[model samples]
Target: MPQSSPRLIGVGGGKGGVGKSIVALTIARVLSDRGDEVVLADLDLGAANLHTYLGIHGRVPTLSDFIAGGMADLSPLLVDTPMPRVHLIAGGVGSLKTANPTFQSKMKLLRHISRLSADWVVLDLGAGVHYNTLDFFNAAHYRVVVTQPEAGAVLNAYGFIKSALLRRISRVFSKDKNLTKALEERVSTTRSRGLLTFCLTDRLSMSPILRGLMMNTGRD
Candidate 1:
C-alpha cells in the first residue's frame, strides 16, 4: 500500500479581533498562488467567518449537512473562491438536530480529513479555549496561535494553553484516582496546592501516568 502524504494546518489565537483569520486566508492565498491545492476549512464551529475574508458571500453548505444525515458527501459543499488552487468547506449553516457533537466527532472529522487528496488543509479557529477550538488546533501537525503584545492577549493565550494542556493531562490521569488528586494539587496555586512551586521547581512528583501525558502534551 502506498503511504499517503500528510496535509493539515491550523491558525488560531486567544485574542479576539487580532486578524488571525486574515493571516490564515492570506497564507492560503500564497500557497494557492504557488499552485498548491489548498482546502480551507473554517473549523471555528459556532463563529466561522473565514469565508467573508475570502470574498464568499452566499449561503454555504457545511459539515452540518453531512453530520445531520444529509445524503451528500462534503464535496458538493466545497465553496469555491476566486483563488485557483483553493476550495473551502464553508461553515455558514447548521441544524439544531445533531447539535454540539462530541470531541470524538471532531476527531472523526479530522481522521476523514486526513484521507482527502489535497496539498494543504488550512483551518481557522475562533478565539478562546473551548474544547472544540482547542481540539481542532491540536489536531493539526502545524499549529500557530497568533497573539499581540498586549497583556489581555497574553493572559488569554496562557489560559488557552493551560486549558489544552490540562485537558490532555486529565485524559492521561482519567483512570488513576490518586494521580488525579495529585494533579489537582499540583495544578492549583493555593498555599495547600502549589502550582507555583511546581512551575519554579526542578521536578514535580507526577505519577508515571502523568509523566507520560506531560511528555505527550509538551508540558515537560
Candidate 2:
C-alpha cells in the first residue's frame, strides 16, 4: 500500500460557505496554468457546482451515476474546463442507492481511478464530516482540511481527522494476527489493569500511535 502513483489532493472545509470549492477551483486553475495535467474530481456527490465557474451546465455524467450501475468512460466524461490542462469529473446529487454505494461499487471505483492518466487528481469534498466526504478525503494522498475561525468548525475538523485516523488504524491492524487475537480476546474482559491501559501494554503495544504508545503503561 505504499503509494507510487500520481499525487492526489483532496480539499475539505468544516462548514458550508467556507470557500472550499472556490479554493479548490482556484488551485486547480493555477496548477493547470502551470502546465500540470490536473483533473478536478467532484467528490461531493450531493451538491456540486465547481463546473459553473468553468461555464458548464445541465446534467452531467458523474460518480454517482457510475456507482448506480450506469456506464461511464473517462473520454466521454472528462469535461473540458476553461483552464488549460485542467479537466473535470462531476458528481451527481445523491439519492438512496447512489448516495451510499455498496462496498463492491467502491472497490470498483477505486480500481478504475488508478487507470486515470493525470499528473494530479484533485478531489473537492463536501462540507461536514459525513462518511461520504471523509472516505473520499482518506482516499487522497494529501488532505487539505479547511476550517473557519470558530469553535464549531475546529471541532468538526478535529472530528474528521479523528474519524479518519481511527478508520485507518482499524484497517491496518485488523488483520494482524497477534493484535487482532488479543483485541478480540480482551475486548469485553476486565484485564489486569484498566481497559485503556490494557489496550496500551497488551493489545497493540507495538503500535507507534501517539495515544496507545505514549500512555503511561506502568500502572498495568
Candidate 3:
C-alpha cells in the first residue's frame, strides 16, 4: 500500500497581533506530546518569527530557500525545535517578492507540503487575505482562524473566513470566465446589501457548474 499523506492544519487570521502563531505552536506541541511527528511550517513569509517562540535563535534554511530555487525540497529546510517530535520549516526573510510569492511557487510549496513524511503538518499562515495566504489556509485539511475578543478582531476574523470561502469558490469556477465574472459581481453587490449568503445561493442555482460544486462540497 502507498504511504499516507500527512494531515495538514492551517492557522490563519485577517488581522495582525491576533496570536495565530501561538495557536499553531500550541497545536503542534500538543500533538507532539501525543507521540505524533509534526512539521510546523511558518508560512508568514516576510514576517516569519515562529522560531522565536520555539527558542531557535540560530539562522536556518527557510521556505524562502525553496521558493527561490536555492533548495530542491522542503525536507532540507526542516529544523528541529525544542518540542520533541515537532520540527519547523522556517519562514523566509528575503526580498519583497519572496514575501509575496507567485502562484506557481505557491503551488510548488503546497505540493511538497502534502508529500512531507510527518504524521501532521501545521501551517502558520500570515495574517490578511493575500492570495498566497488564502491558498495556503485552504490547502489544509483543517482550517483555524484566530481572533481576539475585541470588535475589530471579531470583524476581521469574519472577513478572513468570508474571503477564504470566496477564494475557494472562485477557484472552482476558474475554468469558466463568464461564471467567474458573474460570481465576482454578485459578491460585490450582495456584500453591500448584507445578503451575501442568499445572493450567492441564488447565483449558484443559475449555474450548473456551481450546482455541481455545491453538491460535491456537501459530499465532502
Candidate 4:
C-alpha cells in the first residue's frame, strides 16, 4: 500500500523576529534525522528567507511559481537541501502581491501541499494574523507558536493564538448563526488572556455540539 498524506507542522507567531523559520527548520531536521522524509516549505510569502538559512542561493523555482500559475503542482518545486532526507519548497522572491494570494489560489496551493510525497511537511509562516496565515496554520496537523522571552513577544504570540482559535471556531460553526454570535459575544466580553482555554474547557463544554466540534478540531 502507498503512504498516506504527509503530516503538516506549521510554525507561526504574531510578531516578526521571533525565529519562526529557525524553529521550523529545526523541526524538519529533527524529523529527518529520525529516518523520515521531510519537506520544509517557506510559507512566509513575500518575506521568505528559509533558503538563505539552508545556504541555498541563486534563483530557483518556488511556491511563487505555483501561486502565479506558472506551475501546476507543488512537487515540481521541491529543491534539495543540505540536510539529508529534507527537501525544500522555497518561498521565492516575489512581489508583495504574491503574499496575499486569492482565496481560490490559496485553496489550490493547500490542496497541492497535502499531496506532497513526504512523511512530514514543515511550514514556516509569516508574522501577523492575516487570513492566509491563520488558514495555513490551522491546516497543519501540528501548530507551533514561536516567541522570545519578552513582554511584547509573549503578548503578540497570545494575540496570534487567539486569532487562530477564533478563526477555527468561525469555520466550525459557520452555519450556526446563533452559536457563532454567542461565542463571539463570549470572547469579546472575556478580558482575561486565558479566555480561549477557559472557553474550550469550561463554559463551552456545557454544549454537546461545541464539545463535539472541539474534539473534531483536535483530530483534524
Candidate 5:
C-alpha cells in the first residue's frame, strides 16, 4: 500500500484574542484522541503564548533553537505535552527576529515540518497579515481563519483574507512582472471600493492554483 502524506493544518487570525491558539489546540487534541500522532507547532514568532494556554510553564526549547542552529533536528525540540499522542514545538517568546525569518530558514523549517513523523501537523500562526504569516498559512494543506462577532474583528478578518489572496496572486505571477503589477493594481482598486470588490470570475480564470487557494479555506 502506498504511504499517506501527513496532514498540514494552519490556524490563523487577523489579530490576537480571536481564539486562534485555542482552535489549533482543540483540533490537535481531537486528532490525537483519534489515535493519530499530532504535532502542534506554535508559529507565532514574536508573541508566542500557546504554552500558557496548554498550562506549560518555564522555558522549553523552541523554534528559536532550531533557527539558531542549536539543534540539528526539530524532533529534539518537540516537548511532550500532557495529552497523549500530542507533542508541541513551542514558539519563541519575544523573538522579534523570528517574526521575519529569512526565506532559507522558512524553507528549511517547512521542509522539516513536512517530513515530521506524524499523522497531523497543526501550525498556529500569529495574528496579522504579515508576509511571513501568510506564507506559512499558504503552505498548509488546509487553512482556517478565526474571527469573532465584533465589527472590528470582522473587518480585520476581511483584511487578512484579502491580504492572503493578494500575496498568493503576487507569488503565482511573480515571474511575470507586468502581469503581477497589473494584478496588484486591480487588487488595490478593488480594496479601495470594498472587501472582495473584484470579480471572482476573473480571479478564477487566472490560474487553477489560485482558484484552489480561494476555495480551499477550511473551517477552524
Candidate 6:
C-alpha cells in the first residue's frame, strides 16, 4: 500500500536541558490524539533521551540498527507507545557510532523517514549547531527552536537560528557556484559592517526565493 507523505516537524534546542524532547513528545501526543498517525523519531544522536520522556523503557531497535545493517526496513523498528497511534523510532542507547552517522547514512535515514506511513513525523533533534542537527532542522516543514527564558538559552537559540539560516542558504544554492560565491561575499560584507547588527532581512536580501521561503515559514 502507498503511504501518505508524512509532514515532518523538527523540535530543536541550541543547548541541552531546554525541554526540546518534551515539546516533541507533546506535539506527537496531540497529533496522535487527533487521530493522526504520528511517528516520533529521536534524532538526538549523541545524547538521545526522548524515549525516557515517552516512558519507554527497555531495549528498542533504534536508527543504529538501520545504520549497522541489522534492519533493512525502518517500519519494523517502530515501537508502540502508551499513546495510541503514536509510534517511536528510538535513537538507541549508548554507542557513539550511532551518534555520528555518515552523511550518506543520514541521507538514507531521511529518505526512509519520508516514506513512513504516518500523518506526522516529529524529529527530536540533538542540541548544538552541528551540521547533522541543522540538516534535519532545515528539512522539517515545521521548525520549532525551543529555548528557556534565560539569558544563555536565548542567546544560544539565536545562534542556532543564525546557523540554520546560513545552512539553508548554502543548501539552496549549492549547485550554483556563482550564486554561492556571491552569497559568501555578501555574508563577509555583512559581518565586516556589523556582525551583531545582521538581521533576517539582510540574509534574505540575496535571493528572492529565500526571502519568499522565510516569509512562508511556520505556515501550515
lDDT of 5 by residue, 169-198 (tens): 899999999998898788766744555443
Give lDDT: candidate 3, residue 113: 93
Q: How accurate is candidate 6 locally (lDDT)?
A: 0.79
The TM-score values for the models, in the order shown, are 0.74, 0.72, 0.82, 0.85, 0.83, 0.81
Candidates sorted on TM-score, descending: 4, 5, 3, 6, 1, 2
Give the better candidate number (1 or 6) by TM-score: 6
Question: Whole-model Cα lDDT per candidate?
Answer: 0.66, 0.66, 0.81, 0.81, 0.79, 0.79
> Which digits, one per residue and each the tens of the lDDT, describe model 2 over residues 1-220?
2233556777885677666787678667766776778889877766877877678888777776677665664545688887888889887764656566776876676566656777777888888767667767777766666666678876665556555554554556877868755654554354335433622343342324212222322123
Question: Model 3, range 1-220, lDDT digits (tens) per residue?
Answer: 1168998888888999888898888878777887889999999988899988888887788877788886667889889988989999999775587798889999999999999989889999988899999999889877666788789987887788778877987999999989988887766555534545643544454335324422332211
Pitting candidate 2 against candidate 4, the one with the higher TM-score is 4
What C-alpha RMSD separates each model from the true structure? 8.6, 10.1, 8.3, 7.3, 5.7, 6.4
Worst 10 residues of 3 by lDDT: 211-220
Q: Return the clash pairs for model 4, or none.
A: none
**How much is the lDDT of residue 48 in candidate 5?**
85
Give Cα distance to truth, residue 26, candidate 5, Å. Answer: 0.8
- Model 4 misplacement above 4 A: 191-220
lDDT score for candidate 1 against the true structure: 0.66
Per-residue lDDT of model 1, residues 3-100, tens digit only: 46446777777878776677678767767776778889877775677777778886777777756554334567677888897888876434442336
Clash tally, candidates in order: 0, 0, 0, 0, 0, 0
Best by TM-score: 4
Candidate 6, 32: how far from true, in Å? Answer: 1.1
